[model samples]
Target: MISAQSLTKRFGSLTAVDAVSFEVGTGGVLGFIGPNGAGKTTTMRMLTGFLPASGGKAVVAGHDVFDEPMQVRRKVGYLPETPPLYRELSIGDYLRFVAEIRGIAARDRARRVGEVMEQVGLSGWERRIVGSLSKGYRQRVGLAQAIMHDPPVLILDEPTSGLDPAQVAGMRDFVRELANDRTVILSTHILSEVELLCPRVVMIAGGKKVADGTLDEVRHRATGGVRYRVELKGEPPDAIAPAVGALPQVDQVKPVPRPPGDGPHDPWDQGFRVLDVRAADDPRTAIARLATEQGWTLRGMERRVPGLEEAFLAIIGAEQ
Candidate 1:
């Protein structure tokens, strides 16, 4: 439903977006994430036809974004980071104005506006002035306008920004509802939101595409291999690391810092030290045998999967 092929945008000496390309299937939700100045908004504006690209092309909802801008605009519903709203207008009036501009039929506009308002939890807020609404409510109003036309694709930048936890959750559910038939590209700094809503993610840094794939795929690629966390007692914390690192199966051993009395039965409290072991193979059996021979008490030995935050950090950090 959406495609970006080497999308490039430049302003004077700086390139805001550089040869970035990705795709989102019909009825799919893709999470776009990056640190500040990573070209997320620049790329999005070009895709929405709000800004022209310096080079390359984008197709949104099957319409060539550059060649057929009008058609692309008609099929895409874009909610920018800061919503375009008229504070003086009442919520209902503002929506009706949008409907008129989007060329919705007068007869169907009322029904459409009502449905969108209810869908975004604004059923009884039609008469309230847009300026008087709280930030969260205003966000809902922005969402309402974006979907009022019932467009086939949505480009939402920070849909849950300024929203409280409850509001954020509600907005997530509403976005899911919108995605039942429409393709969605959501850009946000919130990792948990991406984890909840998007199976695939595209991460960029320094205006370049850094990673793109299913969440697990990216995680594995960034971290390189599986890791195991080991907690052992009856040994000097300082001396145990070198011993573990010498094992044939172990490729890396990173110590997990535990301050005095910090964790459950804190290692320091019971003379145990915890370290994360990344090995060439499953080293549970070898670790157990080694510990038994040394008379060290094993408190915990568990395989650990690198988390999304870890993967995101590793990729973004490396790209920079």
Candidate 2:
């Protein structure tokens, strides 16, 4: 539904976005993440046709963002980081204005406005003045206005920024619900939001595309190797490390000391005697069989995939 090829943007002497490229499929949610001054907003603006790229190309819903900007705008709904709102207007009036500006038919505009308001949890508050609404409700009003046209692609910048915890959770759920049938590309620095709502992520640093993939795929690429935590009973971890390490797939096996207060009554159950295992391929089956033959009871074994936080740290740290 969205594609960009070496998209670049410049402002005077500075290049705001540098040769970034990615794609978002129908019904996909792509989280655009980066630190301050990382060009996430610039990329989104180019994709939405609000800002033209200085080089390369971007297409939205099969229309070239530069050449067919009007068509792209018609198919895309955008909410900037700071929403463009009419503070003095009532919520209903503001949305109606947006619908009309987007060229919605007069007959269908009211129905569409009501539906979007309800979808964003602003139903009964339409009569309330936009200026009088709280931050959360104003955000809802912004969301309602964005979707009032029922565009196929939605681009939101910091959709949950500046909200309290409760408001953030509400906004997160709202974004998830919005992505049911439409493509969404949202820019945020919040890793937790990406973890909860996005299946794939595109990370930018120093105006360049640094990482792009599913959460686990990006994490794995950033971490450089796969890791696992293994536990065993009856035999001390030291007794099995060499055997496990000898497997063709195994790379390194380092014993993790048990936490304090763990006792020998049921040593494995007492606490996790973790074996930090790294490998070229999965070795759990081999390790399990070896444990059984050695009269050692298998307690637990699980892969430890890197999280988004770790992946972000690694990617940005390297760029610095």
Candidate 3:
């Protein structure tokens, strides 16, 4: 449903989106993420034909973004970071206007507007003034507008930026429902949202495409190998780190931050410390051997999978 090939956008000497490309098939949800000023907006604009790319090509719902902008616009529903709304207009009036602009037939505009408003939980809100609506309601109106035409693709930027937990959950559920048969590009800073909503992710930084893959693929690619969390009680507490570090198979050791209830006055908790060990190469056997030889009381040792947030930091941090 969406394709981008080396899409590049430049403003004077500044490159906003540089040779970036990715594809989202019909019914796919892709998480587009990056830090602020990372050109996510510029890229989305190019995809929506709101901004022209300097080089390369993009196709939305089978229409070339550069050559067939009108057709592309007709098939794409874009909700930008800020809800584009006319405060003076009532919700019903605003959505009707949107339906008209989206080319809904004159006779069908009212029914379409009402359906979309209801789909986005804006039922009975048509009489409410746009300016009088709360931020969450404004967002609902924005979403209603985007879907008024029932476009095949939805590009949402920070769709849940500001809302109570309940509102955020509602938005997430709505987006998921929308993606049942439509392509969606969800751009947000919330990694957890991506984790829940997107199976694939495309991350960009400094106008360059940094990573693109399923969440797990990107994580494993970033961290290189598996990590393990080891909690042990051993003699000479001060030598714990060195003892673990001396193991030939251990590549690196990181201290695990103490969690709540770890500082209680319990005798069993004495002389125990937790550490994260990054294996040099399959160090599980070596870890067990070292612990047994040293008479260390092994409380727990579990292999760990790197999360998206950890991978995000690793990839973004490396660019810095």
Off by over 4 Å in 1: 234-252, 255-273, 279-286
TM-scores for the candidates: 0.89, 0.82, 0.86
Each prediction's RMSD to truth = 3.2, 4.3, 4.1
Tally clashes: model 3.
0
- What residue pairs are clashing in model 1? none
lDDT of 1 by residue, 31-89 (tens): 89888778989999999999999999999988999899999999989999988899999
- Candidate 2 ranges beyond 4 A from true positions: 229-244, 253-275, 280-303
Model 3: how far residue 221 lies from native, Å: 1.3
**TM-score-superior candidate, 2 or 3:** 3
Give me the runs in candidate 3 sitting further than 4 Å from their true place.
233-275, 279-294
- Could you tally the backbone clashes for each prediction? 0, 0, 0
Candidate 2 weakest ten by summed lDDT: 264-273
Per-residue lDDT of 194 in model 1: 87
